[model samples]
Target: MPSEQVLLKPRLAPMIWLTETSAPVCVEISDGLRRTLFRRMSSLISGSLVGLIIIAILLYRNPIPAFFAWAAVDTILVLFRFAVIGRLMRILRDPSLRRPRDTLVVDAFIAGSVLWCAQIGVGAFLCMSLGDPVLAVFGTMLSTGIVGAMCARNPGSPRMVKLQMVLIIVPYAAGAAMGPEPWLWPIVLIAPLYLWGTISINRELHIDYLKMLMAQQESSHLALHCSLTGLPNRSSFKARLKAAERNASVLFLDLDGFKAVNDQHGHPAGDALLTAVGERIRGCVPDPADVARLGGDEFAILVHADDERTIPAIATRLIAEVARPYALPTGLVVRVGLSIGIATRRDADNDPMLLLPEADQALYEAKRAGKGTYRWFQPANDADLSSQVRELRDMLPKAQTVREHGFEAGLSVTRA
Candidate 1:
């Protein structure tokens, strides 16, 4: 199978087992989630800064020293978060520098520590009865939202999610456990349930995400490729032509006896022949050169070349290769001839539309001259020949009915 086909195949989840050898799909998902983490972290820091200011104001008169200490700790954490965000922005610019798991771990630890410290200092200042429950409830809700967002953003790594959740929940749980009041002990029980629900939701979201990725891959592949031959279709080929730099060459090919093959053997046999021809053309081209099926028996190849001389050499090879016999599934061998036309960016002034029409005209000339040959596009003579051929085709009878006849020593054929 071709590498393109392999790329279209659905990939397994890389997070099932954490390893350094991750797939490209997983890496892409991780990078996207890492960027999302930066946005979430920014929101979190803003909220934290506001909460710290409000808490400092509330405790300004009664616990002046404690306010200063808490404010100092929060300022340091905020600065560190800003630094991490700066590093994350650098990672966004250069994806190779991404270390999302480590960054997330650091974030989780700092956030958890800040929450724990705030609960301890504020709970003591306001008396345990009111402060402990308020802090516990708020911390639980905040942790749930943070952990849920992280999971939704980066569901490819369950281990990362687990580590973050543990760091986020443990400090708050520990603060509640170590509280001076006995009534606050029940708050610790909520942590495990919250963790379970978050994990379950993460697992489901990850599964759905993988399904979506697979569907998208399949759709994109189908849109750009020929379903019968597994080659790039006409639209893909034209897109490639438009993207090519100067001095690029295009070969337009039409099978000479393809209609006869379908008439003699069957449509299935014709399909098999086309598939084999597509593969053979693909084999003849070098890396970066593209082969595409332009509907029916017409095909196109785009190749990069430094000069005009390279075009004929490549076209010659294609002509020889495409004339080879194809083995059909019904234990019969069939032969087909290719008529190829060459066009280059130099000839078409780098216009894809003009380049294709030029190649089409050349192809018409090649067919007019004889089968199993190639021709370079010449706008002067070939354009008139192409127009005449189109007129002849239009004047031909639309339908023809043939009668069965006995085998004869000689056969006669005529154009419709």
Candidate 2:
């Protein structure tokens, strides 16, 4: 699956559920139905086994070859259904088999249900045609039990259950219309009503299950994301950083003079400033999900870049863009500067835990160089960074833009 789709599918679930859109159900819903059926597979199989044993004893004296053939087919189809389900579950567990979404795997499920359902109908029809009241009664009782069990168990996929119901009842009703028994003929008339009622019940149950699933998805989204900025929170960022262990770059950032804005105007102004900063950073990044708000006035970004210069270039742009003035809901406008630390993962940087610390140390270096300037993490410069910064400053012009030397122009608060 594509990474974007992985993020989007669950997010879209609630919208799909609430709207009752006529759009075709996607793979996620299909997989859930498969799992629901799997949970009830054991009980369904046990019931079938018991019914088969009883039917064998009931037919011991008559020895109808066609009935025996039908029983053999049913038994084989039961085994086939088990195999199909087992393979599908294994595919779900193994990530290697996840890509290129195979329709064959899901198709197997539909095919198996169709075969088993048709087999039950055929068995019922044969029993009715045998002209033995005892066998007919036994078959009818077994068929009714199987249908009811399926109705209860397979509501996760209503269409599948409905299809199975039709397959079973249609053939049985046909047999009722042709058989010698006048008492059983009423079944032919009652079949349509039975199917309609059961289908309606299945639809209701399926809707309830969907509502519950949507609630779970919404709660999970809330937990993983920041409530204020709608960016990934600290914990979620850590997990994604770990997933990108190789060839990763971390840009640790802090807003310069943010406390003064809070102390001068208030916390609400600070919050509005932070939200605007998040949106600006998100707009600049290649993937919006790469940005995170670790805490108040602190943010982090995970970048995938081909060359060493790409990381520094990104850091430079962030310093300029975030330094731009933010207009709040109130009439007041606020200005804040940004300090950035660039750290790239070397081949030796196998552990994800160390990247943040490395970036944080570099952030300290940038702050020391001059509040708005950026710095790359270099272990050798730690002991004497002040001297090196002075050396660089002496070589350049007294004033510089953020793009030229990561030193941005000053800003004054104004009325919007």
Candidate 3:
């Protein structure tokens, strides 16, 4: 015969033991709360599974009330699982979303809301269905306020959680003492969950901020340093140019035979020659001046000066500096010339990049006139570029005069 004593009493004591022993243990590192929350979720699922097995075992004897309670909790567990799994997948899809502030807000909102709903809904269901009015009210008030407190004390703000818990639980506990029938329990539970959701949304705004900082740092380094020569690049040159005074002059120098060096000695020897040339140029520029490798085989120098005398002297010094022969790795003594273009800050804007093009044009003229020389963008040079149309008009008449002179010379030679 089955004992009525065993059937009448639920295994409430054993269930309590299972819940307590299996409760999550998370070591709170500075970021320990996240791990704790994760472990708590794991514990909840595992403990719920155990509870379900126990429910199945007890179903053979008067399973009505037990089945209803287990099914209600189980359904709530499924909903919580769905919410958590969705969030996990989203985080995996976007790794940036899992960073501290972003992750805390997101997980706290979705997971906190699901848990809050489960706690209250399950509590209310057990209360109404079991007909234990005292137990029902106790479960409802405790679970509802507990969820509120959990939301308040979540990852985003542990202090807020304490305040919220006190405000929420005090009223519920007071009402519980007077049969604990608080009309406001349901509304209080919703407030914290929704508030946390808003906090999570705010966290998303700062995700791009971290990304911007990383990009800015990378760009700053790239702009200031040469990619190949490991020297100050064009951006550094421009900054130095701006700091230069009015009396400072810019000297742009290019290796005259660099292309031939590259063509004859292969690129490896060319690169070595360029590096040696850069060191030699730096040696020539004054201590107060800035030296930079502006681009391939091109260097710019900005020297502070008292008068125009300094610019020509610096240009001469650069020519003498680069005129020395370079000893190749194969021990060949090869000589290369320098074509420098000189410009004063008074004559041009102190923009290294912009001044580079004008200086390059002057350097081209120097090379055309002869190798191993310097040129300046004087008023006459500007006039020469402006006189292209007049030069074209003079050319045909000059050629006709030369042809007539040649014919007259031929007739005189025949008479002789």
Candidate 2 lDDT trough over 10 residues, lowest sum: 407-416
lDDT of 3 by residue, 11-59 (tens): 3443222112122432222122222233345544544454354334434
lDDT per residue, candidate 1, 100-190, as tens digits?
Answer: 3443533443354345434433433332223455544544555555566656655554555666666666665566677676676675797
Model 2 stretches astray by more than 4 angstroms: 1-34, 54-62, 89-103, 129-131, 260-269, 329-332, 380-416
Cα deviation at 310, candidate 3, in Å, is 2.0
TM-scores across all candidates? Answer: 0.69, 0.76, 0.40
- Candidate with best TM-score: 2
Report lDDT per candidate. Answer: 0.66, 0.74, 0.58
Worst 10 residues of 1 by lDDT: 1-10
After superposition, which runs of candidate 3 have C-alpha atoms over 4 Å from their true positions?
Answer: 1-219, 242-244, 329-333, 347-354, 381-386, 392-416
Rank by TM-score, highest first.
2, 1, 3
lDDT of 2 by residue, 86-140 (tens): 7666655663565454435445556677778888888888777666787778767
Error of 1 at 279 (Å): 1.0
Q: Rank the candidates by lDDT, best first.
A: 2, 1, 3
Best by lDDT: 2
